[model samples]
Target: MNTDVDRVVAHLDPGPGPGMTEGAHALMREIITAEPAPAPRPARRRRPVLRLALPGVALATAAFVALSWLLPTGPGFGPGPAAALDIREENGYYVVEVKDLYAGPDRYQEQLRGVGLDVTLRLTPSTPSMVGSIFPTSPTDHRYLDEIKTIDQPGACEKMGGCPIGVKVPVGFQGPAEITLGREAAPGEEYANVTSFDALGEPMHCVAFRGRTVAEVRELLAQRGLAVHEFRDTNPYIDEEAASRTSVPDSWYVNGGYLRAPGKANLNVSEQPEESDAGGLRNCAAPQGS
Candidate 1:
């Protein structure tokens, strides 16, 4: 019931994995001597970080993706969904995995393996080569999705050199453009992700979903007093062709100061927009994390 106890329990009782058996007293000896339990944290304090590089099959897929995909310009490339963004079973609970599509060889190489799970991202045979997304035939909408900047106002410390004059420039601030996650992953009940400009203070919005099934995902939203709707990448950013295939028109959550496709934040990757906003989030504009 407490944080310290929970983490301790995690390692002490990592759960009986599939097909695990004590080969002999030999195996048990190593397992028992593996490591000591860590000191428990107070029930009220925040713990340290969990992830820098994504974990699980995403890492392996990303390795191949990074080596094979480089800089993708559109969808249907980069291992063609090997490191799909899905909510899947991991150590008995559902966790998200992002295949290392763009990770460098030195990065994300070993940080993604889940302790007690043997997971891997699988791609359908029909998918194209990783290079296809990087060098799209018909220009794509994912060119500049992941850029962040921090700037200071130019005139904050400037004077008119002792002259009686005033300046007319504004101060500088740090702002991260909102990211569009829904451009790739759509929301579903079995697994759903929500993103907006306000997420942890940044101008990014997106949707990532992976669940037991589509219908099951819908039910979770209902229980939360939220309606399950469709997702549409019709904002200015999406390409015309791709937009046509993934629009959500009947849900809520878009185009406020926060969400680009406002309303339920339920844009389906293959539907139409329920409402529209000019200068709202667009799909074809750029892709975050390149």
Candidate 2:
């Protein structure tokens, strides 16, 4: 009995079109009354009568259109198939589950484009603790940064050092941004992100190598069946490429280190003691001393 329903019913022509069955008419009535009338809009020219060979299909199509018109058509409510990526709408966010982590980057871009997002995805090799984490290239852009989030399972994330299993993007995001997802590294592949040497699940976790002599750290690494691949200076101003190639004496102090590969470690060493140990040791002391 709603005014919108009355208008829709008035538009239905009972002329020389295919005859709808009694069941089809009943379904049409149910669909029309399924929701309250929507707000009135400006009048438009009437549509021409639809002449169809299939009476039931035509009536059902009309009923579906009416039902869809009554439904909300907001940002997250738009219609799209969930293929390639399992994208679901939840609380103004699109919960996206990547169907194939090993898929080429172009495949990911194509799927995201299908869902109205302008995103680029990169799957990068990572350390154990960092696997499944999400990183956005534009870290300074807070406009969309806060809306992009990682989705995780209840206990699975905790077991994996708190790494997420999925990603979430805002329904209304208009991005030209690049996103990186951490994935398990293949054998002999270096990690893309530099995790702390002592970070949970890292190869050197709990190993006290900080402020030790390079010779002493080498001995410690040898004991753990690991070897130094290269030594880098702890100074932030030093050029990394030049430092990696420069020869470092065994007496230089080891400030920090990280696993570059399965059995290879890259140490951060300096000629002078680190700032924290400036007063503790003027010279690189024996490895026995911290």
TM-score winner among the candidates?
A: 2
lDDT of 1 by residue, 176-274 (tens): 111111111123211111122222212232222221233433453444344533333434575644432223423323332112122232323323323
* Model 2 C-alpha lDDT versus the unseen true structure: 0.47
- For residues 1-290, write the lDDT of model 2, one tens digit per residue: 11122111111122212223344334334433211111111123221221111100000132232111111112343334533344557767665555455567676667677667776666554445445444343322422244566554344222112434445677777776556555565676655433444444455545667677889888988877789876667666766444553359989997766555567776768887676643322212222323
Candidate 2, which ten residues in sequence have the lowest lDDT sum? Answer: 51-60
Error of 2 at 223 (Å): 4.8
Best by lDDT: 2
Residue 222 local lDDT, model 2:
85
Q: How far out, in Å, is residue 78 in model 1?
A: 57
User: TM per model?
Assistant: 0.17, 0.55
